[model samples]
Target: MDSILNPSTLKNLVFDLGDVIIPIDLTAPVRNFAMLANLPEDEVWAIWKEHNFINHYETGLLDDAAFRAEVRQLLKNDVWADEVIDTAWNTVLLDLPVERIARIQELKANHRLFLLSNTSPIHIRRVNDVLTQLNLPTLEQLFERVFYSYEVRLAKPSPDIYRHVLTEAGLVAEETAFFDDNAANIQAAAELGIQAVHVQPPMTIIDYVKDL
Candidate 1:
């Protein structure tokens, strides 16, 4: 509801991962692979939509295998199925930067932190690997807890997920601040009375929270 930075001086900070903490390469891997395999981009996206693969995977309804199998089935062409699955599933994941990681570390000193991400098993694994490679502190070091949509069975833009997180943390909406890249999701949280920050690129979330 309120966009004023630090309006509530929150005791808890909730973060969305993809496109917020980690950069996403939405087109490169999927598009390049589709072109190489001679599959139409529209058709591939059709499969993703049909199965609610993106939402389901993000919400934790589908595992990596199910995600892969669903895409393969959509192709209906056995020969190209595996390649299609690989590209569609792996293309969007990218790395986390050290500066951002440090910023998170800085925020830890002031807020009770938590992560709420709509992500799949595959990307979660990759993100953890990136975290390790960067030699950054473990996610546990930065946040009190981590909630994945897949594990929670609730995705963003769904009030239930936010309620669940608030309940789990024993926090009232007025005492918590949520950060996300999607406007719809921020609106959803606002509807539930949680302060929401619309994460924009080139603006550090740390700057959004640091004491003025």
Candidate 2:
């Protein structure tokens, strides 16, 4: 994604929740798991990669109880309660800076902002709690509409989800800008003719749209 922005051409700004609008440390949960299991982060990370079933929860294939059961099994003799497991697992979600909310609101003056994220119910619930703590509006209040993988049953890097957003929002592919932290999602949006911004570290949505 270019550092400059052309608000004239980009009328709609579509954002990803994690690591985009909200700052999240993907490795935080792994580190927490490592602490729980008293193992090295690398070992826990490797195990997590091998047994990544959170996607099932994100795609709504597994309910919260089922997903928690999977986590319990993953930990192997942790015997932690649901609340304990939820707090540990939800460490993947970091704080949502009030500045990010302000930036989004500033852009919302001219752009139709929308949120699309691949997140599970637990994460979403935790996010709202964070928002409440920060005195920020709900995700729906911040954006025109929010599309969650769990609710929509469609994950990103899949053309179908992008198509669904386009159709549902009555947005033209050429006029929309999709900002995400994932390269695959950026490629998917680009392939569908949307302006895709690869929002990597040290560069945020604020930097991506600095010109606007």
Candidate 3:
């Protein structure tokens, strides 16, 4: 894999959603769950962090109803309302900053921008609702193609998903650059010959592409 990426050689840009484009706390849901279940935050956090349900839900193996039921089962509270489950599950989702949208718009001029995210249908609906409220363009308007884990039945760190996008877009791996917040996803893309960058916290995607 080549460590040096020349902006001039890049023709496509693949971006991750959470923590990359939109800000996500990732642990906000634990607090919400604790409050709803009247359990210690640490306890709820422990269960959530160790659960495989989230990955299953994101990969389309579990539907919304099944996922909610699993959450209730984990909390040992079957009396929880659907509203409570939704609120707790959505706590990690935050607004998409206007600056990031501006950056994407700017990048649109020269690159075929695409989105590949490991997210559930519920979260995607919430994100779209937020975008609507903000009077911003929908994800479709921002990217040429949007690939969600639930929709694609595949998630990041899986080479098949990366290959799916590349094949579908008719894009060459060496000519594409992928930006993700997870190190594992970055490694997967890199292994497939895509120039991958791990966009860490305190450093926005704009900062990563400013030099390009």
Candidate 4:
């Protein structure tokens, strides 16, 4: 993986959604589901790991109804309604930091901004709804283009997803820079010649773009 000390020549900036732009508590959904099952959070997470509907849902292999059905069985009791199931499932998403949003908006003045995220319809709906509630612009409005894994049927850490975005957006690999919280995703993008930065936190994309 490579990091450009000076990103002056990069024409496009690609951002990963969760953690990079918006902070997420990965354990939140597990905790929420565990409450429903009367199981410990770790136990519910273990069950989730076994069934692994997360990857399937994010990759578009499962719809909301199918996902809820699978999750219901994890409870070992009566099924919960769609509203309850959705609210519980969406607990992983947290509020988007206003500072990060401002950083990206400033970056947009000089660079073509794009958002590429491994996300599901359910997750994105909650995000947009929150943005609406906050009187903030939606992701679509913030980015020149947004590539969602569920909509595209491709998820990252996969080179194919990176390639798909590049080709579809007519972006040159060398002229673009990508910021992601996931190392695998950063590596994949870097392998394709995009300037890639692994955003290790307590640090963020703002750290990379704040002075630019």
* Top model number, lDDT: 3
Among all candidates shown, the one with the greatest TM-score: 4
Model 4 agreement with the true structure over 88-190: per-residue lDDT tens digits: 8789898778888878888888999999999988888899888878788899998999999988999999999999989999999988989999888998999
Worst 10 residues of 4 by lDDT: 1-10
Model 1 clashing residue pairs (backbone) = 59-149, 59-150, 60-150
Q: How do the residues 146-171 of candidate 3 rate in per-residue lDDT, one tens digit apiece?
A: 99999899988999999999998899
Compared with the true structure, model 3 gives a TM-score of 0.92
Q: TM-scores of the models, in the given order? A: 0.87, 0.91, 0.92, 0.95
- lDDT string for model 1 (81-139, tens) is 55456545666876566777787777777778899887777777667766887777666
Task: Give the Cα error of residue 14 in candidate 2, in Å.
Answer: 0.4
State the lDDT at 46 in candidate 1: 66
Stretches of model 1 off by over 4 angstroms after superposition: 77-88
Arranged by lDDT with the best first, the candidates are: 3, 4, 2, 1
Between which residue pairs do clashes occur in model 2? none
Poorly placed runs, candidate 4 (over 4 Å) = none
